[model samples]
Target: MSEQGSSDTYEENERVLVHHQGKIYEAKVLKVEHTDTNNKRKRNTLYLIHYQGWKDKYDEWIDSSKMLKLNEKNKELQRKPLSSLKKKPNNNINQQHQQQQQQQQQHHSEESDDGRPTPTPSPSTAGTSTTTTTSTTSTSSTKRKRVDASVQESQRLDLSLPETLRKTLIDDWVFITNDKSLVALPRNPTVSDILDTFQQQHQHLEHVKQFADGIESYFNKALGVMLLYKFERPQFGEMVKLHPNKPMSEIYGAEHLLRLFVKLPDLLTLTELEDKTSVVLSKATEELIKYVEKNASTFFLKEYAPVTTYYSRLAN
Candidate 1:
């Protein structure tokens, strides 16, 4: 399928409208597959879909090209009226409100127990009552403010791959700095130029040293010192291992560290070469890929690009 077409298709678990047997029904994508034709040269994409009201036996793969994606507007149109499903509050809430009113009436009645008209509350007593009510109101308001702040803290904006990185990533040439910043370089930047850029961008920052230190720790835990050195001059068929205790800075200089950031694709490719016959990926490489995928959205939004375009560049 074309990149444009693939992007338009519903992703897994996304709701869509499916046309089947002269009827249209809401369906969800269960899986997506990109395969080759019988000749094994042409790409064909299929979506495994399950219609909302259909039997399990009826669930089947459909051509992705035929699927209709439901946008937010379409979804709103399809949603059933919530009023029909909403349940009225239980009797307990009403009972509590009634009990509070009854208690206040009883207090007023006790004030007139002698059957004579009750005297007005003295200034001091009224003042104390007002103060108590004010305190209670303030406490409730403070609790509400705390709840609002907690909710705000829990909500986080989604991240995406940046367009600048996306465009450069397709060419397999981009650098992600230790500070999680992205820089898109011209095609095929030389090692010297890449290193220079890294230094120029982060040299003055006081945190650069700390960031570099963190990178060293990451190298120690993820790619052992020996494997990391090998990454600089990777040989074919050599297995990469994690060396948790090895010190990265003592063994590998700053140049190798900078190269690691700039030549990430190359490093991943090398890992792939080493584990070609294996089913599982290297732990370090898997972690790296996951980070990229997870932050792709955040990075994309900062640079502001279509999600499809970002994904297309990633695939490249």
Candidate 2:
């Protein structure tokens, strides 16, 4: 949660409407972090949040952005999980984090998505190319950089999609793009859950564990820029609304996680790797996806939740 107003912060024991599990619940701030930082850069405030009724096991380090004062109006704010928001959303996955300050006016209605006019990249990622020199104008320099980044994205990824899983990707696409329905977010068996399960199942293979980190590292990094479709960008958007700077793979479900598989080759285009290492890594990726696909029955959402659930529409 990156955006916070001064009033948003709370003293220890302050009650808050915690946005958790796609629903808001009352919680108390048990502890606060980053209270001492005075640097000019954005200081992320982490709260040791204790859900009122949940056992201590549910306590989490929550970003301040997700904390809302416990008030009647704020109570109904649609803190819908990204895996579950209804309606249209914009594209340009990376820009999801360039969040505007929370809209003060009540947002009683669902957000509508028009086509995105441009693409944006995350600050953490550097453009792969820098050779193109442009005019002194800032806009021209920015264009030059984007062109360079696109150049590296062109490198043919070493990983190939398995035929069966490839077919699943097609189904996933039609489910979202053509069906106009989203896989309700904070998904059950989230991408994070699935990955962790896979890692646990294969812990004996240390290399597989390492590759899990490899994929997770890039999954958090590349998901915004590489993994999202225009309609699905709403998933990422809902996340930003509730938890900025948090990794998407963790909260997003198997549906969006599958997108990571499609884009990983392009996103992780490793031009500098040795040929032998590349083959081993590519083989590892194949093995990982096969495991994920094999458990589709348990992992994938069977009935896509309509964004306009009665509870959601009744919110606020």
Candidate 3:
């Protein structure tokens, strides 16, 4: 369940040979768990566990502690006896070397073929009933590729909210989804690209001022007030960095912010008051604990961790 040797690659659903009870077994990963070491005095590492395996033509869950990962080359070598594939003397070493070089070039080219950036739908067409196209231009090619097919039929919603309000809402969401700790927008993401139309509705000046005012107004409230105040300075830093380029809401998706905020109360509900030490509050607060409980079961699904990491910035 742990990386034993020198390879840095481990992928879900890939076939792996592991040693269990002195027998070689084929297994696929069920999950990857990262052991937190920020607070501990030891080196931190991740665990790669394979709970299920194919045995006797039936699927079964087995204790993964007995398993040891085998290198791919070792596994392949094991599949064939050492005597069967004896190396022959190079009667045509020059020709063989050229052929080897050509094959190596082909492999290198194939790996570079994975350089395309994955395209996602524009935020504008989130929930509407229309279709549209959002083209993504690859650096390698001059022609723009249509990545978002839904754009052709998606119903466009009004994105006419006042800039101030939009910024506030987007700021909050960015805090929630990105963990309010991001100093700037990630490279390649423009303001418009991250903001969805649904969020634009809440990004007006009146809305943002109202939300800011509400934070002050509700400073005495039990649920949101304490949480908002704790994050106020960081949120300001976020806004400060976001100014002069695009409105806050445009840079930070508003819907994502709201989802992050709404989860606070539920998160608070789980922690014991006495256990609310500063260390826990800073790293895994009650809200974070709740958020993890709410989503932990799904974090192991192949795509979950990446999305969760994006949202963790907000949680932070």
Best by lDDT: 2
User: Each candidate's lDDT (Cα)?
Assistant: 0.37, 0.56, 0.32
Model 2, residue 71: what's the lDDT? 78
Give the higher-lDDT candidate: 1 or 3.
1
RMSD of each: 25.4, 21.2, 23.9
Lowest-sum lDDT 10-residue window in model 3: 112-121
lDDT of 1 by residue, 59-138 (tens): 54555433556765434323423231123235442233233334434433432111111112212211122357787878
lDDT of model 3, residue 284: 27
TM-score, each model?
0.24, 0.47, 0.20
How many steric overlaps are in each model, in order? 13, 6, 26
The superposed Cα distance between candidate 1 and the true structure at residue 260, in angstroms, equals 11
Top model by TM-score, which number?
2
**Which tens-of-lDDT digit does each residue in 174-292 have in candidate 2?**
45543446677777776777778888887665477777777777777766665565556655667878977677776877766676775565455555555666666777777777887
* Higher-lDDT candidate of 1 and 2: 2
